[model samples]
Target: MSGEEGAVATETPLAALGETMDLMTALQLVLKKSLAHGGLARGLHEGAKVIEKHAAQLCVLAEDCDQPDYVKLVKGLCADHNVNLLTVPSAKTLGEWAGLCKIDSEGKARKVVGCSCVVVKDFGEETEGLHVVQQHIKSH
Candidate 1:
């Protein structure tokens, strides 16, 4: 192949991969902030409950989640309440990041629910990560 065609072919997939990695990195940051601070509520039920009370600042949903009704309900509530919505790549990954797993007494892992809502009530002095995630979502 010609040098131009070879360069195009090589760069196309890498560019797509880069975008995917960037989103994953951003998702991790959001998750970390949500967990470390007192602003996180994990799982579809918890998130929806917070949204129902108009207490959510932002909502993140895993794009690969199997629960369509969960996504639909959260999306509708977010739109109605003017909360920001974000999509990650996988529910499992998001669950791990949100610490939605527990090690049983038998040393086996149990998966908890997925999805999360970031509450803004206790934002306090740590707003950097929040702004970064908000900006990232807006740009995307």
Candidate 2:
């Protein structure tokens, strides 16, 4: 991530771990809120607002699934518009989170109405905040 498009990728495990930890915390917080509030609509709404705010400087990790169309659409649009897209390894965490999302769809749990959205929101805000702190610390 040293070349073009303003990439700043780091290959350090600790750095990646820190990112995961921070993101998990944010997800937990948002999940708790959604559970308490009895729906993922409010949670996703809050996430969208945060994502819109940090659209320029964030890499969103979307969970991959058999339904690649919708997954890539959301992530790709964000990327085409300049937001970064990172695909995560699909797992039960995402599935369970979706189950908790309070969606009324009978199709599948692929709706952007659950933990993935929460993680996207968490990634945006936390990553943006960390970047701001990094810039500040560097300047001073």
Candidate 3:
């Protein structure tokens, strides 16, 4: 085999491995995985509780949260605990990703309005995506 062909064969594509997922999509994937594995906490109250307990691995907030105070509170908690924090554009989307939405007859997520915060206590076996997200946050 040629040298270039051998190198290409041994290399792994970042996108194929999920390393190329954007921050928002990575956050959603982590939330979904956490929900299924039992380490997800939804909403301000539960997220704060998790952060206060020093159990939060990552904290995700919605940029369009109606309550400024709630956003400040979660940001403070994340700062105090040194947990990784990320923000998405909308709480409704965040809620859907956090598994708070109900499936409609059309098989799409609906209702449940929005969630202001979501804490990921653990990423279970699917942690590479979360690590990539964390690295992205740290670099920015």
Best candidate, lDDT-wise? 3
Q: Give me the overall lDDT of model 3.
A: 0.84
For all the candidates, what are their Cα RMSDs to the real structure? 11.6, 14.4, 8.0
- Clashing residue pairs in candidate 2 are none
- Please give, for residues 1-140, the per-residue lDDT of candidate 1 as tens digits: 59799769864764466433455665565565667676778776677788888888777777876767867887898899988788777776677777777868874548755543333323333444455566786887
Reference-based lDDT, each prediction: 0.67, 0.42, 0.84
Give the range where candidate 1 is weakest over 10 consecutive residues by summed lDDT. 116-125
For each candidate in turn, the TM-score is 0.64, 0.34, 0.80
Model 3 TM-score, 2 decimals: 0.80
Give the Cα RMSD of candidate 2. Answer: 14.4
lDDT by residue (1-140, candidate 3, tens digit) is 69789658654564457446777777777788899999999988888889999999988899998888887888899999999888999888989999998999776997766888899998876556677687897898
Segments of candidate 2 deviating more than 4 angstroms: 1-63, 95-140
Off by over 4 Å in 3: 1-19
Candidate rank order under TM-score: 3, 1, 2
Evaluated at residue 53, the lDDT of candidate 3 is 94
RMSD in angstroms between candidate 3 and the native structure over all alpha carbons:
8.0
Query: Candidate 1: deviation at residue 138, Å?
Result: 3.1
What is the Å distance of residue 108 in model 3 from its true position?
Answer: 1.4
